[model samples]
Target: MIRLLIADDSALMRKLLEGIFTAEGDFDIRTARNGNEALELVRAFDPQVVTLDVQMPGMDGLTCLSRIMIEAPRPVVMISSLTAEGAEATLEAIELGAVDFIAKPGGAVSLEIDRLRPLLVEKVRAASGARIRRTLRLTERVRHQIRGAGLASRPRPSRVSPSPVAKIGKVGMKPGSATLPGLVLIGTSTGGPAALDIVLPQLPADFPWPILVAQHLPASFTGPFAKRLNRECDLDVVEVNRPMPLKPGTIYIGKGDADVMVAPRAAGVIAMPVPAKGSYLWHPSVERMVASALDHLEASHLVGVMMTGMGNDGAEAMKRLRLTGGRTIAEAESSAIVWGMPGELVKNGGAEAVRPLEDIAETIIEMVNSCAAN
Candidate 1:
């Protein structure tokens, strides 16, 4: 049986969650009215998973998550309101070790309860087996520290460059690659939602290439994230399913358990799934996406963009793009919330260019236009 602790300031919400999980069966439910009570229950119940609300009296959910992770380390799912402040705080919780989050349903009790049932249950199941840790190293400190010193913030290329375009053709193109000029592969995590908000909306509707994104998010969050992105961007943003065809001006988000890969089919471009066992530390591996794009698309036509994220998930993949004659861009540190992943790529010489979030869309569009003209 799975054990769960539901911590919320709302008695009604606590009861509703209890009913939903109880109806699902196999759950030993525990409830807490506040973060302090939740911590007490954690010591006694030792539940396998926790569903914590971000706004509670006294200690907030993020503080509770930090304490829980340090004291007894267990997977936590943050329950947040749908407001902007709530979204920002919930994202902070994820960075603090919460496995995922569920937006609190609004409106009538019946409607809210019904909408959250499936998500609450699914997150509990996913969190029950997750590996929770108390601490993670932040490696981008050196880069941030160096910038504070008056040294040139951007790394100077060892060799003097005549022009930015001079390095363009040094990476040779592969045969029979896809010829679309607007398609791009984007990888992001940690602070992705905010960064994506800054980046995606800047893309023009006529942007020719399809976008394949691998954001480190759990299953339930992906739908909401896609919906949010779709509303913000001019392009059609949707989560990719098994055998879904990739189309121009469309954005495909990788599913939680599946590694999304692109391959040319007789009918056109299709997003396919690979088994999950060998996927990198994170699910919906970025490496799988980048390598798959390299294998299937003509290198000259591919543009890989890595945004603000934790860990070095996209570094090696970006290196492969550099070797494959594809353009690679990393989010500049000043714009990145965490900067671990992109910082690693920039440090390792994997990224061809480093730019702030605002410039990524324009840079990508320029690369596509340049390749098309060539």
Candidate 2:
């Protein structure tokens, strides 16, 4: 049986979660009324995974999460409301080592909560097996130090500090490589937000190729995520709202509720939103985006990269891209948070190169530079 902990201040919520998990029959459940209680239960129960609410009296989710990481680190899934502030906090939790998050179906107590059973269970299961560490990076430590020191008239480092880049040796094109790639396409899910935070910031401001991203996220979350990326990264990250010519150095994030596709116009390619169809399992489906690229851009001028995610959404499409002379890269297993999507591509022979997360940005830069040279 899977060991699980449900931490929330609301008695109603705690009971509801208990009922849901109990009904599932495979989970061994434990409950906590607040963060303090949750911490105690974490030590005693030693759950494989935990579901932490965003807010609670006496100890909020963020504070509790920090404590847990310091004391007893394990997979944690945040329970958040579907609001802007909630989205921001949820993202922060993910950065703080939470595996995933679930937006409370309706605020405190809604019957709709039951509707999220599948997602909640899935996230919990995934979190239970995640790889995490209790120690913080130097930059991360400095941020907490500043906060605790009350910003005392001292030089403070940025809060969202980048992780150290792993030693990535040389990566090169295969023999008889197809035409040089001009467009860059990236597809990711699961722990992608945190992964993107690492890779995107490493690219230069003058990155030559136009880039597109298809990350699995809700409509309410992507805007804030894009804004966060724009603030932290050198590249200009913008949400795709209408059809406009793709520009170099700009990263277009597909809208969360719709499909983003590239259309060839007389002047250039324009990205437009298409209504979601049941055929696509993920909103802003990666496969849909790649299909559009295949239709409009030359195969040789396209590069597809599949990063950390939970499904094989882009595997077949990446394979097709490779077959058509486009380059493809998959995140190496060791560097992936889940290795689901990238693993799919690598398993299916779609990737020409499998690279570590720290190496992916550099690899892309090299691919673009080499393609330009060719």
Candidate 3:
């Protein structure tokens, strides 16, 4: 059974969340009215997952999250409002070792309760089994430094070589075999729903190439996420199935309880779902997806884009993508809800282009066109 601790100052909010979790069955629920009370409950209950609100009467959620990472090292999901300040604080919580967060809907307890039901349940389940390690002091120090310095104006590397243009399938003119997207991989997290909504719908129907997405999401949510994307986008998007063939304009989303990788098959590409064990310390690992894509696809035709999210999950992967002669783009900070993931990529020189959410679709289309032309 999964055990959870709910920490919030609002009496009604806590009651509603407790009621929801209790109704779900198999969950042992505990409640805390403030950060101090939450700490006490943590010591007493030793819960598997914790849902902490950012604003509390006494110690704020960030402080409690920091202490929890130090003392217990359990999975924590922050509940924050959608205001700019709330978003900034939530990002701080993530940096302080909170695994993920859910944005409170409409700044109201009732509306948030309704909109967040699915996310809350999914996060609680995912957090229950996560092995959270004690956060190192150095990590926190580095995060503080990065935040203080402001990452927006960091210098970017000059493009050494232009991306090769490649065309695939019936979408466009057949390029001389030289130019083609060798591998197509995407990474997204928090704010992915809205960002993908904007980007995917703009992609033309029958666009050629196999696209793999590694969105940081719990297993229960991937199926719905893929379906939602499929409905809005012209291309086919589906949760990955083992041994499935990789085809043009089809997207395979990594789903729950497994890490999706691509392996070369005599017939074509095969979806390899590995046990979660160490395959992904976190769900929908961007590193695993990017590494697998690079190994399976030719270097010259690779393209990697890191979308909005908190933390640096995709940073290393983006670096690997760059080393292999692939084109890489990151969602610019201004357009991102959290900016932690994409900002890290930009700071580390992993992204070849930093673009707003509105421009991502056009940028990708241009990249594909460039590949074809090459």
Candidate 4:
């Protein structure tokens, strides 16, 4: 049986969630009325996975999450609303150690809750078996160091050294070429936002290539997430809504509920969002986006990165990129929140180099600059 806990201030919401999980069977359900009660139950129930509401009374979701990470340290999926504040909190919670999030549909007693049944069930199942990091040892200084200058109030020197597994190899590009490949494609999920926060801010403001990112999130959350990233990153970050020319020193984030695709236009390669089909497991699928870019751009012109995420959505596509002479980097297991995505890539012989999260930006910078210099 899957040991599960649901924490919400609304009794109706808690009951509704309980019914959903119970209907799935093999689930031992426990409920908590608020954050304080949730903490108590966490100690007593010892559930494999927990679903926490962001706006609970008596400690609230964020406080409860911090406490949970500090105390019990289990996989947690946050229940968030579609509002901007909810999106911000959800991102913060993920950084704090939550595995994923489910957007609350409608209100506390919303009948629209049915719309979230599929997502909730899937996320809960994933969280149940997730590998969570130990946050108990992260002091304020350690956190600032791990997350880089992006999340902290004070400025610090960025580290850009290569990891033990990083391969500093030669790019097979000729010198003095007018048209060189200058597109960076990054795909991540599960624990992607936190990884992005670390990497995006490390790139210099004059980075020559345009970056396209596909992260699994809700449509309402992507914009706010991009804004958060923009505040810390030296490059301009925006949520891509329509077909726009790719620009240097800018990062384009795909819409949460859509698949990001690239096409060659007269101006340049432009990114746009396509509505996700029902068959797709990952919204804004990393595989679909990278594959689209591969169709139009040469492998040498692109740098493909697979970060901390679940499943192998982009692994096969990354393998193809490597075969065609593209530079590929997979996030090392040591730094991954979940190593599924990058692990699959390495298993399939898709990656050229695998580096820890802290070294990824430095490796990318070095690779891009080398290509430009050659």
Candidate 5:
């Protein structure tokens, strides 16, 4: 049975969550009306997982998450509103040690609660087994990476700070720059954002290839995440909300609720956002993105890097990439928040190299240089 705690300022919400979990029959449940109460119960109730609301009277959710990480580290799933402010705060909670977040539809309560129920339950269940200490190490890793890239700030060791590289100016790519030596395709979910922080900031601004990412996220959250990445990484990052010309040194993040694909255009290859395909299970679908890239570019001119995520979204497409001469890398199990996706690649003989999160950037740089040399 899973021991769980639900913390919110709303009595109705607390009761609502309790009922939802109770129906599952295997959850041992507790509730708190505010952060203060939640803090006390964390020690007393000793839950395997926690559901924390972003808004609470007296102390906010981010403050509570900070204390929880320092005092008794465990997996936490944040419940947030689907507004812009809520997305920003939710990302902060992720850096502060919350394993994942589930956005509350229609503000704190809504008719959409029924639709969100399964997602909320699944995330909480996933959080129950997450590695809290891995998150701490990741926080440290990103800080060290930023400092090496000349963008360091001394934030707390366990905290994911606001854009450590925000002061670094972005470099514009010359249109029609020499054929992209290669394009890097990264796919992740679950612990992806923090994992990205460790890798993207490590690459220099003039790095040869453009990067495309397919991270599973909701529509409301992806825009904020892309903006956050733009500030934190030296590479120019933008959400692919429209057809954008592929540019070297830029990172294209697929817009949430839609898929991003690369295809040939009269001017050049453009990365464009398209409606999610019905066949794929996850949106900003990794499978579709890699398949699309292969349809237009040589497999040898592509590199697939699979990072921390919960399912095998990119495994098959990338397997095709490697079999056809493309280079592939999987995040070593040691550093993955969830090994499901990368593990699938490893099992299926897709990855040419399986590297830890810390080594992936260097591996990418080396592979890109080799691809260019060829």
Candidate 6:
């Protein structure tokens, strides 16, 4: 049985969660009334996965998560509300090493919880299997940020090997031409936000191609998530709410709950959020998004990046991209929290280069520059 802990100040909330997992018959569960109690149980009970509430009585969820990351590193899933404030706090918790989160049931009553039961259970189970080693890497990032420009951070991802210029973007594009720029298709989930933090921040404001991101999130979280990335990165980041003109130096985040796609327009190529495809298991699906891009744009002009996430959402289509003469990069196993998405890409022989998380930005830069020179 999977060892699990549920931590929340509300007795009702705690009980409701316990019941949900107990019904599954695969969990050896424990409960905590508050953060202090939760901390004690973490050391004493030693659960494999933890569920923390955002608004607990004693120590708030964020603070509690901070302590847990330092005291006992384990997979954690935050129980968050649906509001903007809840999204912000949950994002912080993820940065602090939480593997995933679920929006709490709408009402104080248990009846509403049935709707979230399946997803909540899946997230908790997934968290149980996630690698806690990502937490150590994140802690290193946090410490570097705390130094306040004192010493440079740990080595940035090493310089990518020199690749054929033709293998970069479109094979024969000359510099300074009027031809519209190519697109970068990026798809990730689960630990995507933190993984994006490491890659996107490394790119400069003048990045040569537009990047489209499909990050798995609920509808309420994507807007704020895009805004947060905008503040931290040099390139402008915006949610793909409408059919927006594709421009270099801008990163388009696919709206949550829908699939973001690329299609030809009267003016030019545009990035737009389309209704989620019924066939894809994950919304904002990486597979569906990459397929959409392939249908409208030249395969050689596209660069597909598969990063930290669960399942094999992007592996098949990215493999197709590589076979069709496009480039692809998979995040290395050492840096992935789950090693599912990118691992599949590497296993399938799609990834032209497998890079550690820190080196992805430099790799992209090199690929884009090499393409430009050709």
TM-score, cand. 3 vs. native: 0.57
Query: lDDT value for candidate 3?
Result: 0.71
| Cα displacement (Å) at residue 142, model 1 | 34
- 1-374 per-residue lDDT for model 5 (tens digits): 99999998888788888988999999999999889999999999999999999999898898888778777888889999878899899988887778788877674464567777887787788778776655564564565467578984646322222222212111221343324456889999888887886788777777767899999987878889999888877789999989998877799989998999988777667899999989898999999999998887778878899998877998999999999989999999887877888999999999999998878888887777667566
Stretch of 10 with least lDDT, candidate 1: 157-166
Itemize residue pairs with steric clashes in candidate 1: 177-298, 178-298, 182-209, 183-209
The C-alpha lDDT values of all candidates are: 0.73, 0.79, 0.71, 0.82, 0.82, 0.82
Provide the TM-score for each candidate, comma-separated.
Answer: 0.59, 0.88, 0.57, 0.86, 0.88, 0.88
Tens digit of lDDT per residue, candidate 3, span 1-374? 78899999988988988988998999999999999999999999999889999999889898888778766777788888766577567655765667667766565668768776876786667556543422233355455466578863322111212223245533211232222234567787765554665566666665667777777755555676677667666679888846677777777788755677877666566666666657455567888877776666665566788887766876887787787677889998767755777888999999999998767777776777666666
Clashing pairs in 2: 182-301
Model 6, 1-374: lDDT tens per residue? 99999999888888889999999999999999888989999999999999999898878888788788876788998999889899999987877788888888786458888888988887888789887665454574575466557865433322334332232333322233224467888989888887887788777766768899999998889999999888778789999998998888899999999999887766667889899889998979999889887777667777899998888997999999889867899999888887889999999999998998878887877777655665
Q: What would the TM-score be for candidate 4 when compared with the true structure?
A: 0.86
Task: Let me know the TM-score candidate 2 reaches against the reference structure.
Answer: 0.88
- lDDT for residue 44 in candidate 1, whole number 0-100: 98
Runs off by more than 4 Å, candidate 4: 107-111, 134-180
Clash totals, every prediction: 4, 1, 11, 1, 0, 0
- CA displacement after TM-score superposition, residue 252 of candidate 1 (Å): 1.1
| lDDT tens per residue, model 1, 183-285 | 4888987666656765777766766677899887655566666776787677899887577777777888887666788777665667876666464777678
44: Cα error in model 3, Å: 32
- lDDT score at residue 355, model 6, on the 0-100 scale: 93
